[model samples]
Target: MAEEDEGPQKAVADPETYRESLDAWMKMQMPAAEDLRVHAVDMPRATGFSNETVFFSATWSQAGEQTTHRYVARIEPPDGGLFPIQTRECEISCELQHRIMSAIKDSGVAPIPELLPFEPDTGVLGRPFFVMEFIEGLVPADVPRYTQAGFLVDDATPADRERMVRDAVETMGALAGLDWRTMGLDWLDVKAKGQPSLQDQIELYRDYVDRELSGREHPILSASLDWLDANAPSAPVGISWGDSRLGNMIWKNYRCASVCDWEAVSLCPPEADIGWFVMFDRMSYDDFDVPRLEGFPTREEQVAIWEAKSGRTVGHTIDYWEIFGAMRFDAIMIKLGDRMARAGIVPAEPGISIDNGTTDGLGRLLERQGVSL
Candidate 1:
């Protein structure tokens, strides 16, 4: 979920165009509001290079009274965005996101924005998109590195920061505890084996790396994949919030108000999500050699909180999952870097995407674990 230095040049179409299209669409959804208007359409600067996210406000009439509501639209990227294979193949479609969030909202297991119906017709906005109630809360900014600057570091007291961490972990635990089958989310098990096996998750990424590389050699990823195949551990199949991190949550009153970003939602073990959460903390602080902000719980402390909240044991298995998280992240970087280069946001050259901090971190992790390249 790393943000590029410069915003993607064409993350969305013209705001005016969106305003027009969305206005008409919202009318259909609310036929009673004859004077409904969509305005203030915009793309947030801090959004990562994943789905194109647009925020706008709509004003309409109800009972002869004017009312306004803010909403966010998640659009499919023209270039398939990050995780190109998943988006292109419909493994991670907007409809799936809508269904997942809707289930989670009904389960009340976690906080999610209220959603509208999913719009599968690309003609609505040039791509499939879903509109949801815009949540009013502060999201940890990815562009500025929340550790260095943001309400997370600059304004929040130590106690507040601690509370944020605890609350986020608790939310994750709640989500992990949910039963996908009971929630009618069995379709997320892409392999359709009753549940998504750990091996299937690993192979999915291996296939992703191969497709993203297109024959380009990535030694660190290859070695990590080999190690994973040989040392895969068994764990309960549970819900994975795919990209779990502080940046993905919207906070209100130092507590998680809404959980966003469901493109990576899967049926992997809960450990995968925890691994991602911890791995990103390392990337934000340790990888950059930045001192972690005061008051945030240590890695062990955070895991302990998760254990208590989720009622699950996470022992050495976390080490394996952390490496798994790193590998998945590195694989995504390959596609992300290429997308940036092609957009002229970064230099276009060989190895421009692969030879970077993510790969380096993956290499160091393998070395520390005695996995030789």
Candidate 2:
């Protein structure tokens, strides 16, 4: 039998415990009221990235009435699957999602599940984590897996899939539509945020690849870099969903409920987002999937879509960033595979509970998923 979860506990073996830990913190954040009802907010299970994830039911009492609800918390990895190892005091990579989501919530682009709190107290749980609203609708990824086998829900129809896809794309446009400068996070120190250029991105990945892959040689790797260098996209970078793949987008009712896992958000080539969608969504490549550019629509098609949606002629050649982003995924995963003692490994979280669940049963760093719902 699957292990039963206990009070605001931790799942260190997994990453999702951030949710539980977050609730624990929320209990403190919200002032207890005679009119408020609160009970054991336990997390069950949810899946994304290499973190330990669990969902739970909540009941808070108010004015002799009970308020029941649900929400999700993202904690540090109890296992593995975090990537792009950096030797620094703080990581821009790790905190990317937290910062951007906070901004998006402020910007009013798309809906975001309300954030409760984030904290890292080993004494409380086991590691660092945050909490957010639990989206109760049919999260796109689960419907197919939990609902059927080999039915290929992915093949249901382009219309349903289109809603999902449109949401993903439009979310990008919605975000890109924002003015970063007005947002106040527009310009960050290069040292802190790293250079927001194709070259800076390339060098960062190159270093990541050399250290993680032990400098493993792949012809495609060099070809990809050479291609990006040769055919670099035009400059003045806006926000790019560094990992804007299908899985990163959270869908509900055939439309995007939230664009999440902002773990890869960065200021790089605007086309980078479009390119990443092509590599991961269109080409059916996992993080490691690299595609031949000739078969896909011309760079013009992508620019047209972005320009039409974002209302700006941002980039006409994102093929470079697409190739770069795909390679980045491969390099990160290769590093993850190296670090994991088990198949899944994640960053260290203080006091986070570790889930010793059976392999991939909890969907930690899933190897197979699709762009369509």
1-373: candidate 2 lDDT, tens digit per residue:
3434433334454334444544455567666633333344455453434554445545666677767767665666544335543223225332445667888889888777787655555455564566677775444343233123222143435456545555666677777776666776643323455445666677776776566545455444444445556666566667776667556656666677776776656556566777666655433423223342222333355446666787756553454455566666655655454444333444333101122221111122222221111
Off by over 4 Å in 1: 1-12, 45-48, 84-89
The regions of model 2 sitting more than 4 angstroms off are: 1-24, 33-49, 78-95, 142-157, 186-189, 192-195, 285-303, 314-316, 340-373
Per-candidate Cα RMSD to the true structure, in Å, reads 5.3, 9.8
- Prediction 1 TM-score vs. true: 0.92
Candidate 1 residue-wise lDDT at 353:
78
lDDT value, residue 183 of candidate 2:
76
Write the residue-wise lDDT of candidate 1 on 68-91 in tens digits: 999999887666546423323354
How much is 343 displaced in model 2, in angstroms? 4.1
Which is the leading candidate under TM-score? 1
